[model samples]
Target: MKKLLIVSLGIIVFILLSLPWVLILVGRNKLHDYDIPQREQLIPSSDSKKKVLALFPHPDDEVTVAGTLMRLKEDGHEVVLVCLTRGEKGKSSGIQDEQELARLRTSEMEESARLIGVDQLIISDYPDSGIEDLGMDSLKKVVLNLILEKQPDILISYDSNVGLYGHPDHRLTGKAIEKVFLKEKGKEGFSPDRLFQVTLCKKQVEVALKLSSGFQRNYPENPEMGLPQPDFSVRTQPYFDRILQVMQAHQTQQNVLKDLMPFHDKVPAWIYSRIFDREYFREVK
Candidate 1:
């Protein structure tokens, strides 16, 4: 009986150690299982040459809407990326010094912006993971000034209310943008015609939660997590190659990329293309 019990314990330990590899295998297979034909619906048309501004807290945040940016550029609209920080405070191996990491990340971000067809890139001085420490009034002012200067027709950012598992920087940057939008939208002076908050579809969130606890453990206990009802979605599968290229640009964030997107080299190109298959956004204005 004791021998059987020891064998069972050994089996459990082996399974626990192998669980991550198994999950990645399952995730890759599941990517191919999605019905691509059913997801090929056309995105809404926008006027030619419209200006767009995306505000986010970190370098890689732009990946969330990479395909949308590609489409906007293809449509002849001017797209700009404004990141709140260089993501210098992100997780890093002991090899690279902090300064070196920041420089590498900044370069990666610029390359990503270029790949995404961003005509302009504005990186602010706010510290990574420390946007909350920046006063609310200051945060709003910084974003407001950019909106006024750019005079964009569209603004996009993370969903402030939920903030992709409640990262403080993500939450603060988004809330700042939302506050600016609410206060200035249709005001006598300057404002973007519309504000769109990017969100994870329920399925994506559920998958992420199941596949990795990194994000799930950090999600705040907020009812707002359930709130971002998407008003529209962009079928980004057509621009899949570009999205993957953009993600690859941020090589310093390989771990993050792996976690945020269940992609691997072994997966077929068609299946991996589903990485940025759909991007959901809710119109706040």
Candidate 2:
């Protein structure tokens, strides 16, 4: 009886400790790719000078499309990065005050933008993590003004319908851009030719979250987290180093990433090299 009891306790401990990985395996079993037709592969001509505009909610959020933006710039296209907020509400590395944190984040963003080869970086005054609280009409106006000023050929942002983790700021930023996009699209000589929403694959999210830590609140293991079906997926294997450098520039968010990612510095080059190589995008309009 004593031996049996000991064995039971050991089994229970083992099961409890492995529960997270078990859940990850279960979630991954449900992964399935959609049978969507492939869109034309984008190959920019070296002389083509397409103007691209990218809108994101925070300083670090730009990392989502860093590789794409870098490729566009290298191909002779101009790219502009419009950050909605300074990431004042983000987890702090060492700063105590929100204003100081915002300042540091802005500096980091500038450095990242320069290195990523963006032509311009625009910073908005909206409160960090408070985008949805603002009136939609007002947000639309702000985005519209920028779109009118820039006259970009392509616009990229997060998908409002299905955010990576349903972040309110990300959803709201996408919503505002959608409204402005539709409004300007019908206007004469004004709308962008294409609009793309950066997204993640279901299988990729499942495996990544399994390896990550401290993401329960942000990236719950919900089916809605991934794009229903991606319209296009860009392979960015060649630009992995560029994207990593861009993410590293957000010094204040380094600790936060490390907490979420299993690798030291929150990003192991080999792991992300495989995971982020394929970037998904849905062309909404």
Candidate 3:
């Protein structure tokens, strides 16, 4: 009877503590990608001569590059956001109607664009769920048209291994984009002659979170699933009010941001500003 009691206690303990650790371990590995090495800190210099184009899988991807976009725009570099989809599945609260949700997501994205002073917002007809491998011909055509229209000097998009972080759509989009970027690179008439990826420094994620107003709160399983800091970053503190304002515009993603959390929200604004860090890719010319 004593031995039986001990076994029961051990099983109970594993069921509770062991389960959480398993979740903490495998859950994190499955939740976000940790492949990219985040080491360098992005430092901005004088005004950049390059006009940058950021390609986002969804509306919120823009936030990942928000600081860089804000700085680039201020420094005389034109910035445009190309949202590949309307982000229809982002119904976190689960109260919104599906059709209404997609429409609302679009509106939210629009509001975000306005806050960023972004001149253009492109929403592709690609399905909300799968953008990476869908009609390559159609995607190429869409991207090609944007190249002609925006004439960006640089192109930015998700890392090639989008799925490592647990989102299949992200990876597929990466694949599709890789094809499109390769085809358009240096091809006459395609604007934005270069390409870059949105990366974060593993070491700087804490910094990224601080600068980002604590975005990406839930996926802490592998906080490293988050991208490393980009090699080049901009200080948008001068325009942080605008940054915070735009951040609030993403109402759907509110729960995802950590700053909105209880304890973090209480911190002073100056401190938060010091912590913010954002980065992205620059395609090889």
The Cα local distance difference test for each model comes to 0.76, 0.74, 0.60
* Deviation (Å) of 124 in candidate 3: 2.3
Candidate 1 per-residue lDDT, tens place, 1-285, comes to: 999999999999999888766765565454433432322222345444678898998989998889888888877778889988888887643434767777888999999998988999998767887888888898999999998898988888987777776677888788888998887888866758788888765566667777756577776556455537666667787888888889889888877777777645456556556454677777786
Ranking by lDDT: 1, 2, 3
Model 3 poorest ten-residue lDDT run: 35-44
* TM-scores of all predicted structures: 0.82, 0.78, 0.68
Compare the candidates by lDDT and give the number of the best one. 1
Query: Which ranges in model 2 have alpha carbons more than 4 Å from their true place?
Result: 1-47, 208-215, 219-226, 258-272
lDDT of 2 by residue, 53-149 (tens): 9999899887777777777877778788999899998865867799999999999999999879899999988899788778898888888888889
Over all chains combined, what TM-score does candidate 2 have?
0.78
Off by over 4 Å in 3: 1-50, 132-138, 204-230, 259-264, 278-285
Q: Which ten residues in a row have the lowest lDDT in candidate 1?
A: 33-42
- Lowest-sum lDDT 10-residue window in model 2: 32-41
Candidate 1, TM-score vs. the true structure?
Answer: 0.82
What RMSD, rounded to one decimal, does every model reach? Answer: 8.9, 8.4, 12.0
Q: By descending TM-score, how would the candidates be arranged?
A: 1, 2, 3
